[model samples]
Target: MPVTPDRWNDLERLFGPRGACSGCWCMWYRIKRSEWSSNANAGNRRAFKQIVDSGGTPGLLAYVHDQPSGWVSVAPREDFSSLERSNVLKRVDDKPVWSIVCFFVSKEHRRQGLSQALLEAAVKYAAEHGATLVEGYPVDRLEGKKFSSVEAFPGSVASFRRAGFREAARRSPTRPIMRRRVRPRPKG
Candidate 1:
């Protein structure tokens, strides 16, 4: 579900003090490279906290029997400044899109399909928030090659495909821009 202030503790617990892999705190795309490098760890933590404190849910969190299990970073494409400046993940079209930028699954929850579930939730959340399209930048794993945890954070192409996203473009052989159209849930 969409993360809120009430769930901050759960997220923090899932990310730990180092902020999920060297203090990224999932701020790699939200801030400039220099800023991210300097603001890593504590600075990134505070930045992410401000977003949650202000009632801005930057993404959705998945739970396994009430315990936070995984996360998928989804927000307006424009929200990720790094993507806009990315030569490999440049805009595919003028269509406004909600971007699914990152994923973090707990060690115990790895390979349990939580990433896919998180992605599904992200698309639904975006649709409800008035997004017509959802976009993702995923790494295409080479045949027979293994992907390390850090190398797969953006997500794998198969995961996006399973979530019903299609390859929209690929500037680099290993990176593909995928997208899926979304329909908002009808109001009761």
Candidate 2:
């Protein structure tokens, strides 16, 4: 199961003291740029915590046994302004979609396919939540070189493909808006 209220601690532990890369606490996409900068470390954490307290589940957490190993933020595409407002990431159509906005895994848990696991869960989340379509804006990974953690928040193209999403549009050279239509399973 995905992380719930009682498992909030796992999410906190995964973020660590620095708020999972320079005090972002994964709020980089949620808040306005100026506000994000001003709030810094503690600010983002508070913002994310408030969202959780209000029972607005922003994403899913992966645990290896008991500890939080990774996180992925998936919600209605419009919920992430940083992407919605971006010239590079414009809407493909008027169709509504749930967006997989970000991913964060503890340094110790990096490269363990947790991002993929979280994405799989995200698809399920979207499908169960009445989203007929799930979308993602992911980066194309080059061989050998690694991107800054901040830059990698959108996840890699390979990961999205691995989770059964296909490219819907590619306007940017390095970024692509991929999508998967989550058809409801037939109930007997």
Candidate 3:
């Protein structure tokens, strides 16, 4: 399930004063570049608050020791226009897709595989919510190459693979679109 008001403080603490891993506050995929850069701090906070206050959950939050530890932005693909505009990440089909856009883990929570757990939770969330398909655009780095948590916000191919998501298409060598089917069984 997505984060709610009760979980906001945990999120704030998890992200700390920097706001969810380097002042992003998880705003990269939702807003345009100019706007995002300009409103990096205040605007992002306002946007996140608006989503929750309006009874909408932009993504799920992970808690460790009863404290917010991580976050991932997941929702209907169409909800994020910035994605469609990107040359790298665009619609592959007219069929609706639930997209897992970004991931952010608290500094203290890094390297604990929290991302993989959040991803698995997303699969279940989509399944429960009647999503026929869930998709993600994860980075595909060269073999043996490594990326920091921030660099892998979109997630790594290996992470999505662990979540039972398979490659559906690859528009760019470094970007592979991964997907998982969560549809309920059809009536016989």
Candidate 4:
């Protein structure tokens, strides 16, 4: 389900007091670094809530047994200014695309293929909204190597692959830009 005003409580419960990582509130890419630093915690939470309350579907919420389990931030590429500023993650092309920038799954829900499911759902959600292409920047891990959950918050390359996304660019050793084409929903 998309994060809306009615589901604000569920989102808050899932993010907890820390705001899903040191007060990030999943606003890291939506604002400038200086602004994000100043808005950490309560400020960030309030800002995110404003987006939800204003009827913005900033992301999707995954539910498990009627409880919020995970979140994936997907939006038009322009919505994330930070991406345009990052040399490493800059636009792969001029083509319009929806970007998947973040993911957070409850500890208990980790490693259960929830991330992949969220990726798939996000693609469908974007397509429904008229996006023909969806992109993701996921961490590429070497075989048999392990990393902290925080490092995987953007997602793992394996998960993107499982979702039928193909590598579109690799400007960094461990970060790869992946893409998937979707047939947008037909208009009436």
Where does model 3 exceed 4 Å of error?
A: 184-188
Q: How do the residues 39-75 of candidate 1 rate in per-residue lDDT, one tens digit apiece?
A: 8699999999998899888998888999998999999
Residue 180, model 2, lDDT: 93
Rank by lDDT, highest first.
4, 1, 2, 3
lDDT of all predictions: 0.90, 0.84, 0.82, 0.92
Q: In candidate 4, how many clashes are counted?
A: 0
Which scores better on TM-score, 3 or 4?
Answer: 4
Model 1 accuracy (lDDT, Cα): 0.90
Worst lDDT 10-window in candidate 1:
179-188
Candidate 4 yields a Cα-based lDDT of 0.92
Steric collisions counted per model: 0, 0, 0, 0
Model 4 CA lDDT for position 82 = 94
In angstroms, the error of model 2 at 87 is 0.3
Give stretches of model 2 more than 4 Å off.
Answer: 185-188
TM-score of 3: 0.91
Candidate 4's residue-wise lDDT over 79-145, tens digit each? Answer: 8899989887999999999999999999999989888888988999999999999999999998788
